[model samples]
Target chain A: MDISAVNALPYEDFVNIFGNVVEKCPLVSAAVWTRRPFVSLADLEAAINQFIDALPESGKEGILRCHPDLAGRDLHRGALTRESRQEQAGAGLDALRSDEASRVSRLNEEYKRRFGFPFVVCARAHDKASILRELSERCGNERAAERARGIQEVKKICRLRLQDLVRSDNKL
Target chain B: MDISAVNALPYEDFVNIFGNVVEKCPLVSAAVWTRRPFVSLADLEAAINQFIDALPESGKEGILRCHPDLAGRDLHRGALTRESRQEQAGAGLDALRSDEASRVSRLNEEYKRRFGFPFVVCARAHDKASILRELSERCGNERAAERARGIQEVKKICRLRLQDLVRSDNKL
Candidate 1:
């Protein structure tokens, strides 16, 4: 749908179109709905990012926790939403061979152990090797730094999902 | 670290060297130590797999949970064991950019949600895209079937790690 159509949509309908960009934080869409008539996709994404960025640490953690581990346990069982499934499928994570899966799992475990949460990133923009490389490298960051980085990653992910949900007047 | 050398090492040393081949389940290394006299890497790997295969469902799950999500948060934070890091690095999961990272996280979430555990696969055997594809496909399997698949994947992972731990008599 276009930006105007998205703005015109009712509360639930607007959320229905966009709420899932953040996995557990469905209310963000409703909040975004209040700031309707976005000038462009950039405007909408920036609003969404601003709202999330302004949240307290606890709130941010909650949003972070809502996401699953990359190629972690959840995907093995077919439990993701349709959008999430398609997102992963686009990057080929859906057909990992045995060893690549293990590498992904190993990094995930170490990252959570250190950071108290999963690493967040925009999967739509990367491939498997680059993800692993980043995962392997990012865990070295200080907790605060990683947390900040994670927020940025979450923004990227949300922005991409938003783009998918709305056919922007101007492309991202 | 040839098999003969691995076989000859003292008990503690043996466990120390091989203890973490299976992610969370460190006991495998100790157990493997007791069943020593490994003539080749294949013999050592076979014994480990056989023991794991014979475990009860709860035991299997316990071992499974010990592993992290593929391309998950831990990798980003540099939390993987050295062996895990190298293995993942070998397969290029260490360098995933944003979009691929998202795909892995989504697949992991879906798989765990359905199977009550992360999707297990041998990382040494596949590239990132293949890993994503397999993860997407495997999540559809029946729970029992998926469990069996996970166990096999675990075995594959362990074997690869073991090879790294023990210099193979003949390269794999």
Candidate 2:
């Protein structure tokens, strides 16, 4: 759909299409719908980012918590949301070797144990190797900084999802 | 796949195919793989059900917790697992009127708050109206009984999924 199409959506249809742009956080889409009549896809994304930025720490954590662990049990069980499954598969997470999967699983468990939420990464932007490297390095960071980093990844993911959903009208 | 094809699968392939028969509980699939060389579809289902039955209370609740709320935010967001999306859509959950959607959302929240897990009836078995009715009725039960009832529904869901995957072999 184009910018005009996006701008014309009813609240329900808008929320339905964009609700998961933030990966399981529909309220973000719902809130951003009020800022509609977007000039371009970028404007819609900005509204979403602004809403995310204005959230309290607890709310940000809640958003991060909604994400499934990359290549974790959910993937194994085929239980990930469709977007997540595709993203993880794109990152080569679905094909992890036994040893690699074991290592990732161990790191994921430890990361959650330390941070009180699963490690959040934009799998679409990283191959499994880089994902593992970042996960290991980030494990040593303090909680607050890691939360910020994770939310930034969430925005990156949101941007990619938005790009998929809304065609930018370059003619505008 | 037929019963013979199912019986011939490697552990990894087997798990990949049937892991979600229990909805985010790959452990059940992993455990049941040990009993393979299933004589028929019924035998394969029996193995899966036995694995679920063997779980302690917490494990069963854990399985229930893995399910998304029926016609809740995930559905609106298009974030449901593929199987769940199809089952919910088959139940006409995709077309709920605004008021029905709101009622389901409210009942879902209350059910979770009361039981500590989302209300999980197999969407394949009921249309939207019956789902709402059950959600209302089941809310009055104690946690223990609710957990058991939810698991039974999980088994019914598993049976349907298994039927889809493996054709029954009527001949010996």
Scored by TM-score, the top model is 2
Report per-candidate TM-score of chain A alone: 0.91, 0.95
Model 1 ranges with Cα > 4 A deviation:
A168-172, B1-172
List of clashing residue pairs for candidate 2: none
lDDT by residue for model 2 (A52-103), tens: 6765564566567667888888899998887889899999999999999999
- State TM-scores per candidate: 0.48, 0.52
- Error at B129, model 1, angstroms: 58
Tens digit per residue, CA lDDT, model 1, B23-104: 6444555445545688888988887777666554545654565566777766789887776777678778888888988888
Off by over 4 Å in 2: A168-172, B1-172
Evaluated on the second chain alone, the candidates' TM-scores are: 0.89, 0.94
| Lowest lDDT 10-residue stretch of candidate 2 chain A | A163-172
Over the stretch A62-163, how does candidate 1's per-residue lDDT look in tens digits? Answer: 456566777866677988767667777777888888899888888888897787667887788898878889999998989879878888888888877877
